[model samples]
Target: MRQGLILVVFAALLPVVAASFLQGQSALEDARKLAFERMIGTASAVAERQRDPFVIGQHLLLVHATNPDVTDMTDTCDAALRASLSSYPPITNIARTAADGTVRCSAIAFAGNINLAQEGWWQRGVSAKGMTITKAPIYGRIAKRDVLFLILPLRSGDGRQNGTLTAAIDVNYLRRALHDAGARNAGTLAIVTRDGKVVTDSNNALAFKPAMGAEPDQPIEARDKDGTMWIYTLHKIYSSDLFVVYAEPRAQLMATAVAQMRAGMLLPLISILLASIAIWVGTNRLALTWLRELQNMSARFAKGDFKGDQARFERAPEEIAAFSADLHIMADVIDRRNTDLTQALEAKSQLTREVHHRVKNNLQIINSLLTLQSGRVREGAAKEVLAQTRARISALALIHRLLYEQDNGYDRGEVAIDNLMAELCLQLRSARRSMFQVELTCHARNFPVPVDYAVPLTLFVVEAVTNAFRHAFPAGTRGAVHLNLDLQAGDAILEISDNGIGYSVTDEAGQMGTELMRGFATQVEGNLSIISSEGAGTQVILKFPLPNMSITNAPPLGSVPAF
Candidate 1:
């Protein structure tokens, strides 16, 4: 129930949480887009400033190329180049080279044997009629510094190349120009070549190598050599092969937006947490407490305790109070019904026992009559028949007596087969004629069976043992009669064997006993087998299934006193 309440609260608050998250994400995206635009603008400004030095150098070279002193390599040409270099701090040197690659004039002094014959920029300049710039910065031999060169072709009247005019712009001056332009920006600024070379950087501490594949005017994130993340953009510098890079730390760029988003989301999260707590507490107080009390009362009722107090639920809700009242009424009804059933069961059990006692008394009377009749008979055959009849009657009487005699709490109608067999063996021993010196030994295990099963089983044992007593021992031969009842698998085995002079089945005297024993075995759904020979002893074995009932209360094997 508490979990259900929490689920309800969570479901109710889920939409608010989702909406806040989406709104914060949208705000964050907007902040990032604005930051990207500002950084692009700053980069464009720096690119423009970086282009200025190259543009100024091109214009100066064009002007100087037309002067007579510079073209003719007059005595004042070196002085003229020096004056131009001093005026533009970014231009490190100005020089004029002859078509054959000899240096005719230079602002910076060097060995006169130095030639521009094999230089790539000079060869290209001599071939082209227009101004040209170097692809990347190079170390200037005359200026002794890293520089980018601008070249102009000097031509004769027929348009043949006369010589070339070159100006070397210092790399340090380009870096200063980049810094001045982006000083107000938040991060590093740099000028890079088309092939990802860093020509000049405002902050050398960071790796300013911009990606060559990056599109211009767009921002992308990159990690530097020191594992710092940056958001930077690239802008081309005015048709030149150089690019300006503006970069800022990613954390700084998104800090304000992240803070705002977190501030916006905090309240809703706290509200959900508090609401869940309230629901949990409120549900326990209002409903679960009363439900728990009702549960306790029901458990007690299951254990037959119906004396739980109902007044304790008077202050509960109307539904709970009414439910408690109903449970109390139910408990009363069940208790009364249980008492009535118990009384009726006891009365039935007593009547059944009384019936068994009367039957046993009547059977014993018949047995006594048979004994009297056997005593009067003079013929040997007639006396033997009467004695056998009396033994059969006595067996029946014994079953009834066992049924009624049991004071144990188990059903009185059921007979313990082990006890019955032990008693039967005792009776058989007592009844044996004095003429036969026969010993009887009984070994049986306990099995409680209903009267229906007990009757046939007891009779079967008696008939088998009696047959062995009469036939197996002849002329008063000393022998033993063994009766055994054992349990194996799910079946019970009853064996009656004797060590005496055995007789064949074809003999007239044994036929009747065999048929009678077979009938008894069929009645109890058992299989009967007789093993006998003319000289050896006989064994009558009866195998039958035990009744399907609890036998835990039955005594263990060898527990019953055997005779």
Candidate 2:
């Protein structure tokens, strides 16, 4: 209860804290906007100043290019290059290159005769018709330090390239200027190239580092290494592929928010504390104990133990008492219905057993009459047909006997398939004991067979067995007949084979038994195959789908001579 109240108090205080925090963020944003504008202006002014030295050098080269008398490339441009270098000290060197890949003039006297045709700066300048700036500062082969190149192509009278004029500007000069501006404004500044390279930063050590998360066209806010909030703004430099970054840190940004929220919530916090105490005491005395007991009772109800005689809810609130009474009424109704349903199920089971018993008795009487008629006939095909018919009838009668002996008649009474086949084979073998000495081996899996499936299944096996008994072996011949019934992959397989005189598979005569076996198989949606040879034994196989409860109609119990 105390934990819940504490959480409630925390939830109530959230909006106040959030409002104060948003207010402080607003102030920081305003300050950042002003700082970003100032930094951008500073960067623009610095970029213009940095371009001056290169512009002066290029102007000096343009003067000589327009003069007609100054046809000699090196001698005419040497003095001008020296004069420009002396004026702007940041420009380390200046050079004029001829069309034949020769550095014709230089501010340094010994810098002549250096070939610059293969350099990236020379290639780009010769192709560019106007002023071009290097995308990245390059290390000068002669200057031995990083330098930025500003190239101006020298065009002749026909606007064709004659040679190139190049100025090497010191990178340190721009870095120092940016550092001074950052120190004065209490922020950091960096110049980044378009390809995410930080060329220089306010701290001299951060050169060539990966650029921070600043898009070239917008401003973003983030935190620095010391958890100080900083806003970064990006400004693209005019006439160049470089971006200038301005970052300002608001050291006490969140601290002011936290302090304001604490001061404003002083009265609210005390009031919440007193209210929480009163709520705790009142709910404890009025509802908490009874509510806990009610929760336990609900748990018991969910588990089907709805007898709530032990619940002491009379002293609780009127609503709680009324709810308890309703629960008790529902439980009483459920209990009485359960008892009445059990008694009805018992009565229905007894009636079903009695019905199956009478059916078995009537089937046995039919089998007895067939037996008496077979005995009166001479030993010929007529008597043999009666005997086979009687065997089939007896097989159907055995199914009902098994169903009558079941413990549960309402659960669609199941029979063990292996046990059923074993008992059937034993009875069939005993009936033919005097005719021939035969052994019937039954192999099957034990599976719960529903009554509907059992009826058709038993009749199908009976036809196959009797067919083999009549045709496979002759009179007074001892032979072994094997029966294998197994359940595999949701199909029932019944196989019968006999080591007796075989017949030709091509012979189509005496097909009545074959047709009868086929009909029984089709009734169960099964397939039948027979293999017979002139001298070898015969084998019969029947494959059918597993028995299900869909066979509501009882199977034909009499002989199937016409199939």
Candidate 3:
């Protein structure tokens, strides 16, 4: 029970814990992604500021070089460049040079002409014949600082290059922008030229070095040498060939997320634990205790103890209280029905006893009337036939008397064949041979027959014994008559034999008695055969199948043909 309660509580808690855990993980991932985007946006804003000066200087130089009637072109262009340099902090130097690399205008006033057409930045600008941003910051001989140049070609009215406008950007200013933008995020930021060279970066060593596996103008996630996760987000500046890259440490993102998740999950986890404990304790006290008591009551009911007070079930939990009430009602119904059946069975028994007594008395009166009738007749065949009829009538009366005598409850309407035959032989001898006493003994086994079969079988036995007493012996004859009834393999066998002078095989004088015995055998569904010869004792045997005691009615007499 304790284990079951624990399992149920854990089952309910598992989903809540899992959902909270998943929610924490989702919040952490969202925060990390948001931080990644913020760093990228910061670097992009700085890159835009750095590109503003080149855009302004290009406009100024193009407007001045386009005027065909300007006599002081150098002074006009030089004044425009000086004004642009002062206004923008990232612009360090601006110059206008002819296609032959002779300086036409300069922010610095030089005494003589300086040729710069063969310089690396100048040669690349000449080949492009348009605005060109340098791949990496270079040490400028004219400006005397690490700088990048934006050169725009000045086209004549005929669309041929006349001179070039060169704007030099201060690398320190670019570096400072990268540093300040990255400092806000507590990570590294860099601006790289299109050819993978770092133009400016927060880290000094990383400046002018190749970017590590970075694609231009794309967001990427990678790891550094020390195995810290870094997200590198890139934004291309619009007016120049530069990429602004922002990298934030994954560990810092995770630290912030972890703190958030800890704050978010504390109360829910504690509440789940407390709720699980409370449910476990509450159910054990309020529900499980009542259920256990009800289980014990059911066990007692199985053993036939249905007695319980109504207050006991009323005090049970509401879930099973109605079930308890129904069980109590069912037990009461069974007890009342049991009492009713017992009284009915006792009344039925008394009625059966009275019926048996009345039947035995009525049959005895018939037997007595037959005996009186036999005495009124003379000593002839008529009188002999009356004596046989009286004997058969007395056999049926004795069966009812035996059934009445049965006091055992199991054998109430049954006759024990052995005891029935013994008492029957004594009664038959007294009814028939009052003049000479015949030694009669019954050898039989204990088997019960219902009253229906017993009546016909008893009469059959009486006919056989009476015939043997009358014809098997002569005057002054003293002989033994053995009556046997035994059970063998679901069959009953009755045998009556005498040690007396027997009749001839062809004698027809006792045909009536023989036919009468055969008729009684047919009525009981039995086989009767007589064994007699001159000067030999007679044996009458009857064998019949015994059915269950519930089969009270005999089969049709025609069904058992006499053989």
Candidate 4:
């Protein structure tokens, strides 16, 4: 029942847990979308800002190219160019190169023996109809710094190219502009050429290059050369060859989404845990506690102990209280029944003991009558018969005496075979003539047999021992008799042997004592064997199935010695 309650709680909470998981997933996706939009917007804004300096430099160069002093290379042309360079910090130098590669007007003096005739930018600018910018930055020979040149073609009246007016934009100045733009953003920023060369970056340690086949305004994830993951988007900065890349670390980009997911799930998980704990405690208090008390009471009742406090269940739920009441009533009924059975058993045992006492008295009276009759008999054979009958009667009376004397509660109707045999051997020894000098010894294992089998068993032992005392030894002969009772496997074995003048079984086949022993053996459902040979001891063996009774002080197997 407790398990069922817990399962019910889980069943109710399962939907909440599933909904929480789905809600967390939705929250994470929404956070990702919002983060992507912000990243794209930042990339676009930074791209525009980065393009500003290049646009201003281009316009300045275009205005200066149309100036008469600069176009005619007059004496004031170098002074005008130097004044323009001082006004704009982004421009490193301004110069005019003739079609044949001669430096005519300059803002900064040329370094080395430099000529622009073979330069790729100058060659492309001379034949171009309008201004052109270099695809990548180059080291300026005149300014002695990395720069990108904006070149304007000097044309004749017929539109043929004559010379070029050029202004070098400092790469470091553009890098500074990009850094300022990046300061307001949360991610790194970089400008890269179409060929994947980095022109400037807010952070140089990060290889913030554009991804292959990346579309403008679309975000993509890529790993840098150092294996750091980044989420970045690209934007074109005024030209096809140059692009601005805005990127953030993937972990940083997803941090908000992860936090939102965790928050979304936390409440439901806590709710389930708290609910389960409540159910566990509530069930134990309302039902399980009383059930446990009832279970303990039932166990006590099974052990015949009905003394548990019935008031313990008074505060329980109605059904449990009713159950406890019924259980207590049943225990009372069983207790009363047990008391009645105990009283009846005591009365029956008392009656059985009384009956055995009366039977023992009657047998003792018969033995006494036989003893007195044997004294008056004249014939020796008749007296012998009377004595034997008296001995048999004595054995029966001994059995009855043992039954009447039994005080232990267990198996009062049974006689301890060991005690019976020991006393029987004593009686046999006492009855023998003193001149015979027969040493009688009895060794028996301690197990009880019911009175029905005990009667025949005792009679069998008495008759066998008496025959050995009466006929096995001659007058004035010294001999010994041994009686043994043993249990082997599930069979009881009783053996009586005597060292006396042995008799032939063929001659004693119809003897009264032998016939009586055989009849007694049959009564106890046993097999009897008489082993006798002239000049050898006589042995009588009786094997029977042991009664179903516990044995005490039983000797180990094979303890009986060979005669």
User: Which candidate has the highest TM-score of all?
Assistant: 4
Stretches of candidate 1 exceeding 4 Å from the true structure: 1-40, 52-128, 132-177, 192-199, 205-234, 238-242, 247-336, 361-393, 407-412, 433-436, 463-477, 486-493, 497-522, 525-563
lDDT of 4 by residue, 1-563 (tens): 75776678778878988888899999888888999999888878877777776787777778877888988789998888888777677788889877677788799865555678988878887787777778788998888899988888887677766698888888998788778877777788888877777877885444546674678888798888888899988888866767887889988999988987887788777877787788788889998898899899999998989876779888999999999999988888888999999999988878888887898899899989888888899968888788878888888888888887855322357787777777777676666656347878778887788888888988887789888888888888888988888878899888899899998887743288888889999988899998999889799999999877777765653232312
What lDDT would candidate 3 get against the real structure? 0.71
Instruction: List RMSD in Å for every model shown.
Output: 7.6, 20.5, 10.9, 4.8
**2 or 4, greater by lDDT:** 4
- Candidate 1 residue 397 Cα shift, in angstroms, is 3.5
Candidate with better TM-score, 1 vs 4:
4
Tell me the TM-score of each prediction against the true structure.
0.62, 0.47, 0.49, 0.80
- Give the Å shift of residue 15 in candidate 3: 19
Q: For residue 404, give model 3's deviation from the true position in Å.
A: 9.3
Predictions in order: lDDT: 0.82, 0.69, 0.71, 0.81
**Shift in Å, residue 11, candidate 2:** 3.0
lDDT digits (tens) for residues 310-340 of candidate 1: 9999998899999999999999999899889
Please provide, for model 2 over 259-369, each residue's C-alpha lDDT reduced to its tens digit, 9 standing for 90 to 100: 554555554666667768877886776678777887888788777787876458878888777877887788778767877887887777777777877888888999899
Predicted structure 2: clash tally: 0
Model 2 quality (TM-score) = 0.47
At residue 267, give the lDDT of candidate 1: 66
- Model 3 agreement with the true structure over 11-57: per-residue lDDT tens digits: 77678777777888899889867776676677677767666665765
